[model samples]
Target: MHSERASLGLQIAAIGGLLFLHLPILLIFLYAFTVEERTYQFPPPGLTTEWFAVAWNRADIWPPLYLSLKVAAVSTVLALVLGTLVAGAMARSRFFGREQISLLIILPIALPGVITGMSLRSAFAIMEIPFSVWTIILGHATFCIVIVYNNAVARMRRLSGGLMEASADLGANAFQTFRYVLLPNLGSALLAGCMLAFALSFDEVIVTTFTAGQQSTLPIWMLNELVRPRQRPVTNVVAIVVFAVTFVPILLAYYLTRGGSETAGGGK
Candidate 1:
């Protein structure tokens, strides 16, 4: 009886925790359909799909959304290339201060978002670099690289060195070995990392704020709308789009990385 009671309590706790975390997100979805334009009402006076059309028709939304997509794509590409190279070196090579190097690579992500944003802003100002989409991509890549590096290195560490040795012994050149052997093994990790980096860059507000200058990404645009709302439900509709954009990639990344430690090496 005690064991059964404990299990029931644990299930209840789990359900409560999920609700606590996701209830606000549910509210966002609910309000997106609300007919009230200027003010929020509990249980919504009426529900309609009109806000979705309003959000779509708004002239201000498209440019920011396009810029965000562009930045995320460029940043993800850069992160994948740089991060994979760094991970390969870190996983395969041994040298003094290697651990320190790894820590430094990850330091940007470990720091608070505000701190990272401030540092990037300062660096740009000192360098006389203008804030633009490129600057946003640069700021985002700092942490995006960390995500890719972590995923790649974790997969690499689990990989057997013998696989590379076997490829070499089979008369495969350096490029051939990488293309035929390492690349296949690293594919899923890279994909997962890229997806995560893209998702993060898409929704990022803090670093983008510091780096954007006069430009706006979708999140920044949303903030502006909240501060000076033309239609409250329209903002909620945009929020739903943001939620979907970030959530899908993150969910896919989770599934990809969940069994990531299982290495594809040698015969196995």
Candidate 2:
């Protein structure tokens, strides 16, 4: 009887915790369809799908959405190349200060977004680099690289070094061995990392705020709209869009890596 009560208490706590975390998101969904637009009325006054159409028709939202997609794509590709190479070097070879370098590689993700944003903004000022889409991409790449590195390096460390040796013994070049052997092994992990990175870059705001001087990605647009909202329900609709955009990839990444090593990089 005591054990049954303990299990029931644990179940209740788990359900309560889930509700605490997800209740706001559920409210957002509810508000997106709300008929009353100016304020969030309790029970939302009335609910309708009209706001979804309003959000779709809004001209201002499109540019930011496109910009966010472009930055995320470029950043993910850049991270795939750089992060994988860094993971390879750090995982396969010994060098002086390798551990320190590895730590530094992952530090941007660990630091508060405000610090990273300020540091990048300062560096851009010093270098006289124009704040443009490229600057946002660079800011995003900092953390995206860490995401890919964590996943790739975790998988790479588990790789058998002997595979490379045997491939070389059979007259395979470095590129060939990697293409034929390592690529297959690392494919799912790299995909998961890229998906996670893309999702994060799409949702990013703080670093993008500093780097995107004239440009407004979707998140920035949402933040501004919240401060000075034109159609409140449209903003909720967009929130739903962002939630779907981020949640799908994260769910997929979890599925991809759950069967393998623990390489689905969560926040540090």
Candidate 3:
């Protein structure tokens, strides 16, 4: 009875914590449809879709959105490929500095985003590298790699090695075995990792602030709109669009992985 009570209390606490953390986001969504000019107004006065139409009509928003989407797509692909290679090497082989390699893979994500941004900025300055969309892509890839690496490593660990051995014994070459055996097992994790990386890159602002010059990604555009005097309500509309855009990809990724797991189980 004591343990059950404790567990029940813990569940309540967790729910409370989640609500607290998400309160601001909830408010953003709530106010997106608010008719009031200011957010501080009580009960939002009324609700309207004017700001949504305003946001849609704004020409300035599209450029940043396009840049962000392009960079995110490129960065996520790079992260997936590099992360999978790193994960494969670390998980499947024993070598020198293996522990160090793992640590390096995780280090960028563990450090504060500001610190990562600052370091990248300094590196670019020293190398005389110009800030552009490519720079943003590179900056985003640093932490994005960690997400992919983690997913790949976890899935690789869970996968059976006997299959690889069996493939080898059956005269399959390394590339053939990897294609037919390992790739199939890694599909779900890779898809999940790509979605996560894309989401991270899409909304990333801190590192982007340092690396981007003259180019504004969607988040950067949103930040500017937030600080600007006019179009305040329009910012909320952009926020709602961002939430929708990101949420769909995330949901698709979730369902894909779930489906993959079910298929894997059925095969078993």
Candidate 4:
């Protein structure tokens, strides 16, 4: 509908925004392969594949990487189960204070990261809970659950209530109706939600900072590596890994939900 000149301007603006956001990430990729071990060089002095090998062989990196994977996996599972249940209840039911409850469910994510992190730290302190891997999982799950719940509740709201009534009339019990009817309809949404949750949990740092006492996840490891002086290229290589780990799941989630509508644009 716009004039050709206007459209060109819009396209150029969008490209510029993208470059502004992603240029730093691209810089990390460039430096990952650089030959310099200490200070960063402009137009990297040399490039090699050696950092990937170094990162692979780095003994200290593995523990944090393994912990991150484990925490993310567990947190995502928790989010999928709890978030789906909350979404189903919310989308299907009407009751007093429902809006308030909905706000509370989303509050963890709506709050600033620092606020959430501080509250979690304080809660753990009051409860006399020692910081550990489980604490990290709990912290990550708070936000991860919100992501899954947003996806699931949106999808659930779009589904026809008549489908459930029809299932009931067909002599299916609640469990059978859910298994045969709801699960199939909600499958892609749940998968997409879980993928998003996993990616978020895998890279979360602020909440992890409060919850991970004496332990390090991959992000925490990267933060520490940045502060200290070691083979900086190896840290960049790990950053590339972290980026890939988060980016792939997020990209997959986008694809899974791109057609989330029952009708075109129905769930947008």
TM-scores for all predictions: 0.93, 0.94, 0.89, 0.93
> What is the RMSD, in Å, between candidate 4 and the native fold over all Cα?
2.7
lDDT of 2 at 215: 89
Candidate 2, residue 192: lDDT: 92
Whose TM-score is higher: candidate 3's or candidate 4's? 4
lDDT for 99 in candidate 2 is 81
Per-model CA lDDT versus the true structure:
0.88, 0.90, 0.83, 0.87
* lDDT leader: 2
Candidate 3 residues 26-51, lDDT tens each?
88877778887755575788888788
- For candidate 1, the lDDT comes to 0.88
Write down the lDDT that model 3 would get: 0.83
Candidate 4's displacement at residue 103, Å, is 0.9
Model 4 steric clash pairs: none
Model 1 CA deviation exceeding 4 Å by range: 1-7, 262-268
Per-residue lDDT over 16-68 for candidate 4, one digit per residue giving the tens place of the 0 to 100 score: 99999988889999999999888998889898999898889989999999999
Candidate 1: the clashing residue pairs are none
Instruction: Give the lDDT of residue 105 in candidate 4.
Output: 82
